[model samples]
Target: MHIVLQIGSEITRPTFWLIGPVGKAVFYYLAAVAILVFLAGASERVKRYTKGDADHADRLDDLPSRVVESARTVLSNRTLFDRDFVGGVMHLLVMWGFLTLLIATIILGIDMDLYRPLTGESFFIGDFYLSYSFVADAMGLLFIVGLGIMLYRRYAARNERLWGHHTSLEDDLLVWTLFLLGVGGYLTEAVRIIGQDFPPFETASFVGWAVALIIAAVGVTPELARTLYPITWWAHALLALAFIAAIPMGKPFHMLSSFANVVTRDGDAGKRLPGIPADLDATNAETIDDFSWKELLDQDACTKCGRCSSVCPAKASDRPLDPRNVILDLKTYREERDAGGEDLPIIADGGAAVIDAATMESCMACMACMDSCPVEIEHLSSFTKMNRQLVDQGDVDSNVQNVFQNVMQQGNTFGDQARARADWTAELEFEVDDARETEVEFLWYVGDYPSYDDRNKQVARSLARLFELAGVEYGILYEDEVYDGNDVRRIGEEFLFLEQAGTLVDTFEACEFEKIVCTDPHSFNTFKNEYPEVDFAEFADDPMMAFEIEESWDGAPVYHWTQVVEELVDDGRLGLQGDELAYTVTYHDPCHLGRYNDEYEAPRELVRATGCKLVEMPRNRNDSFCCGGGGGGLWTDFDDEPKPSEERLREALEDTSAGDAIEKFVVACPMCMTMYEDGRKTGGYEDEIQIVDVAELLIEAVEIRDGRQA
Candidate 1:
């Protein structure tokens, strides 16, 4: 191969240099060992993922599309670049360069060792060789530059996202090995060029050729370069082998695991969580085996970017939960279980654990972490499963426990009489329909917060008046409606959620309605995605329940009131003119509404329909900050001072005061109305930004229409 390569005018360097047969043999021998080590470790990790449930519907449902999406996601690096531009560029350089170099090495291996040796024909010379040499050197330099940035961020700049919660020597080792490997490849090339009498065609190895000039400029003779060549050559080769072996042993494993995680990601993961399998019960997962295979895969896929923690409502409010720590803790426990360690509580705080009870409870279940996570680890879903275990184990907070009890016992979170669910309508001049008796277009599932909460009740009453005035045929469940169990399911009270969902499913079976609608995103989410999956053995005989198999709207059509109102306003029946009640208002997206269902636009469209100037917060739409209202947030207070809602109010405040005062912080969800209402009062921004529901705004528009007509 050396004679064949040198005879070709030296456009490409030798695959091996200044090494005898014994050296080549040793290199191949170590290469085989590295391959073995990598396979053994990788197989074990993959085996762990497989041990969990393999029943994920979205995992292999659309393999072609999934593969295409995965390819697009990785290539575009959108998730990696979510909030950090420099980090995105850094990753792109490293990822593409590293992948390219790997491909070049494989091509060289096939031509030099496998293909050319057997076929006795060499196509790896001439134009292809020259082009390959230049490309390889250029990519290697890029790879080194990326590594340099990463190391600087880690060690010098001390980027919190990289260094947060935990840092192991293996993490540092993986990075340094990659950095040195790139550096060593160029050094080896420089030495080889020194020995080859500066072949003019060697200019094709542009970076390496420049390195050679520097080496010769430092007064090293060609004879001396020849003496130093073997050491540099072996070092580079060994470093490359080490990289392969070390892949699954440290953070480098994310290269494979994260890609697979993204490819198999559930499009509606946090929004529509996987159901617990028949065999497993929700007890705080004592061991890794308790989690589903996909959840196990999620743990391995974490890149520790801390985007989750940074965006976490709980963590920002001086809460104990660090979203990154949740994954890391689970990962450490898995490692222990693999090492034959006995099962124990992973959530107990204060004693050598990555997560604690406080941490678990601290999660407002906003899903900010999952949304911000580049790898799509399904953080909120995994944590919810663990929370189920906690509830079953009686390790839940008092406030959260009360919420579960109230929801199950009273058909609502307030523990009020069922008749009280309809009491809000008494305040309205017009009567609301009982959907069970009357046929209606929308079966309004009046969620607990909208019905029972004093502040939200006004918003609900206003919506009723607006509906009546618009001649919209919508009726509510009234006394029969149970909590939708969206947040109940998320808060980890699985049995409670099922029981409540079963009751609502049965109610739907009896009701004559075209669609289910809610002022609560939580209710809308469950009715839309989860209600159909409930094993309603009692209602099993029905060919179609009202909520299920709706023909008027598509599969399991459920909508937030904003969606219905958007259509109503578009019809021009409401007579909404933007100038009529034009108030410069910013909108706060409810987590369940925007991030969960991808319904950010409907509410905003309604705002525009009402003639309000829709000013936006910095974090609006999918990236909108949570109002500390989902999951168990409505019932509990884990933070020393409530921050998610108040912090969100501050963000809204910055977008206003253009010429007139910001009239209102418009919201679409009842839970958001409650949260931001409290946020305005506590954050001392009551005078600065008003909290008003989208329904309230629409009602105001309706009054304007009525006044103009009179």
Candidate 2:
């Protein structure tokens, strides 16, 4: 053995040092069996996905883009690091370390078993061997370090997110076994090094060399080391084999399932939503089979990081909704059904149901779960599907029923008559143009709450005045407008949304507009993302209208009014008195605008353009807390205390790193304005913080305050 540099063999270690050919053959057989076991377990889960109702071809159509995006997501660990830095580092280290070690194993296998025999020369010789050993040991150390951190996080520090009902004994054992596997590999290397008298090139294996020194200091002689090398080798190899075999069968399956889920995620998932294509009867989600293959995989992909539940406003507000448990309950039901024909509904009328009705109703459909999820589980889709099932069964509470009826009967959620849709405009001294009759640069889709809710109507009038004062060409649909259906679709009234979308699309067809705009982010989201995908052929009672829509329109560019006002401010068109309306304000990122549409910057810019010191809440942008206004929460009342909006108002008024208690809680969406206003009154924070809209602030600062003045 080469303790120092010898002629040729110093760079590479013996491949089969203590093990004979028979022992090597036995190891190969065990490895092959492990691979087969992994395949059997993984295939079982794959077969379940085949039963899903989703179009497999749709997810697979953009294979290249999916592959690239998935690779980026996995490698960067971007989502993991969003708000939790410590947890992110732990995952990144563990994942990359494991992946690198796996790649090293494959390289060694091909080199020793295939390449050396075929070419009569070692592919992993000299420089390559040294490089491989160095990298492999470093990554092994990283793997061990990461495992240690995770153990500390889970048990010692007791990070609350890591502990939940989803945690099990298997979760604990999985981490320990993986940690031991990495340690065992290092021990095997150290013993081998001692037996070989510690080769000069082997020093490149820094961790193993250090371990070899420690063992030598402990009086383990070379002869004893030689005796223990084979035993240590077999122990490590068997443990590794067991881990491999259990990958898809147990908790580690997240490695494969998560990657697949991320790859198949829709870029516009919660924003666009899945449209019911052929059937107006309604999209059904009675069982796991009703979901898509990607969605089925989504449940399996959950790592139980509790990120979704942790960030969820509904869950934080003491609502029964928990995104992690929702997915876990479905997974349990899926396994039960697959194993022994378990016929229980995923959600049903009583306590016997897999997920409780209260849990289902508590969801705000804010997309926080999906945004916070490292694996892209699409929790909103699951909630929406389950809600659809409830809607189909008429299992929802009375408030939800009334809200749905209001939208169905009166073209809005307030149950106001059709003529009342444009009543807000009566307060404006200037007559707003009917977009249907006038060609305008921007067609404003004045949504339900903005038109009918008094406070929001005041804000809406301010926006109209701003448009007039800026000499911008914009018009509203007036009484012809209906619910934009963003919330209707989220509430699982698919038929209602389709009809509403058809009516709006028909109304849009009559209007000659260059762009679309709205003060309500929900309407903006539907118009920008969902409405474009609405198959009008599956639409309203008018057949001719469908054909016209199909031919004339594919999609439209829709903006939140903040974006328009920000643009105007940038172009010096709003004619603002600089710093005149300055106030310390914190902006509430409407879920539809921030998470669903990625329009965070525009609202903040508008706030800054008013010369206010923009103070941001701890949770802002995609991470912003929801105000409990989404997914029909704005219309349907919840009996729960400390509403999400009220909690958010409290959070907004806290002494942030940037500023102290904010004077104004600025918002861009009408739903947000309404929710926070109500929250302020109920929470007794009305005097502490003012609920104001960006439009209202801009109007006060604008050179002209009203349209009549213009």
Candidate 3:
């Protein structure tokens, strides 16, 4: 048999099987119908998404930036790889290989239909054609390799992430469809090569060449191959079209939605919770239509990889809050609502609610879900919005209600007299300057826990001494400041939070200070991120927003104490004696400071500056476990078994112990100190470990001894 090289012809087999207009017409009809079906399904989803509130339309404004960001997110695949390298590699291979094959198919179509008819010349020829054939063959095999890994993970491997979730039949069907599609494609190529008696140059498609040789050795006649060619060709074409149509019908929709999710994600989502809308009563989302369009879009975007649940402190504590389930449930509610079913409340009366009130309340707003999500879904915001509806309806638990009432009536969660905010000042060696009485360089905003909690009062005093030693001209807001409303807003008490934040911003504007410093990460996050958007005039007439002055508070520069100490140390203003302390210390990253604001290094550097050997917990920095004190978790104990704080303490204890078996568990946030102090006692580690704030540890290293400041 002689081989002929058709160098200037298209790489693909004859379009319409070189048969006639009938075959060409049929292929076009099927392809067009498949495309139309996909668009129809996708359009329905888009309509459902638009049914949500209009706040998310802003995401559509910046086209170029969105495209760049979305492309970067999809191409980098950092979210998956950062957590699990092996799984990330497998996904990257499959994702890129699929894209390459799709591109090849488009090029082939253009070469045959557009270029060949216009110029009577194939665009893919010579070295380019050979390279294309080689790459297509190699990528096909790689695609199969990826599918094999996925199948093994789903069936053979003990993947706990996938085990608990409801694995639908649709998921299995999607995978099998792709697998068979790949096989059919490669087999068709092999059979075509054997039947055509193609040239040696065609062997550049090595996988097809090898398979063709095997088929020839098996005594498959050209006549038999010719008959099989048309069957395999049409089957492969139909399968490809079917895959496209199936994309928007099931879990496969994630391919498109996830990319859009990354592109259109709120830029400052995890950094700041959404502000309560101007019309407080009407803004809370009670049902599918009430949710923001982005929230609705998030439902379609979720891949159900279970990463959020895997890292959730609430889920680990056996609490009702499962981030993954929350997204899935919301998705279900939307689907049902679109199907013309009975209108269902997202947070219903009983435990059987689509998303129960208990589940909404169970979240600690630790932001693990938001951080771990590959598609950048704002899980925390979704839960908070649902909680907002519950709060408006007076459906919150008694403890939560009381906490909200305390903030409204007392300006603090402790329900203490506002005057007592400055009581911690009495313990300092030198009277701390009052920002109300005099202009100061730094206005220290002592948060609720540090001002009222006895254990945290020591931390406040320690920070005061450190400030004095460093000659940092700082003064406290004294009785003038109210709660920062960080956790209050997160807990769904929007009106109460607005009142508190408005009052605080009013005081901040009245006080003459260059910068604001916070003892709590929560307050720091609130002041830095949330307060700037407050419009005080909107609530001026309300009793809770009773401030003498008006005008929206212009944005103020704010710093957490850890940030201040780190800056001071870096600038050589705050000197450490570097006395070698005989203790092993591990630093815990508070949720607000680490994940919410990305200030992990500052606190750790302060710990290292204290002269103690700094040992890291397995999950430190951005991945650090929550201390069960954020998002009103400190105010209302949900009685969750194996408390998150206890779990964290156990992790701290696992670090290699120095003298006295890791003497200190240093923390930066006052809330963290409060949680861990109680955790140390309840976890029975009081004898072995001590919970010390970073400020307190810093003072120990910098404190004056023998009439000289260290």
Model 3 residue 318 lDDT? 89
How do the predictions measure up, each by TM-score?
0.94, 0.94, 0.95
Residue clash pairs of candidate 2: none
Q: Note the Cα lDDT for every prediction shown.
A: 0.80, 0.83, 0.81
TM-score of 3: 0.95
Instruction: Report how far residue 111 has shifted in candidate 3, in Å.
Output: 0.8
Q: How far is candidate 3 from the true structure (C-alpha RMSD, Å)?
A: 2.4
Candidate 3, residue 94: lDDT: 81
Give me the runs in candidate 2 sitting further than 4 Å from their true place.
1-10, 280-283, 539-553, 639-641, 658-660, 703-710
Better-scoring candidate (lDDT), 1 or 2: 2
Q: Could you give candidate 2's per-residue lDDT for residues 1-710 as a string of tens digits?
A: 33333336546777777798999999999999999999998998888788888642377767998899899989989889988998899989999899999999999899888988898877677887889999999998999999999999988999888888879987987899989989999999999889988877789999999999999999988889989999999999999999999998868999999999888887777777776655545357776788878778888999889999899888787788889988988887888788886587767657677887778888888999999999888887778888888888888878878888887789888999989889898888899998888899999888888889999899989999989878899888878888877887887877778777777787887889989988788888888877767766544445423224443248678888888888888888876646756588898888988888888898788777778888888888988988998887876667767888888888877656544457898998888888888899999997888999988888777643343357
- Number of the predicted model whose lDDT against the real structure is largest: 2
Q: Where does model 1 exceed 4 Å of error?
A: 1-5, 8-10, 53-58, 277-284, 348-354, 538-556, 655-661
Clash-forming residue pairs, model 1: 283-389, 284-389, 578-611
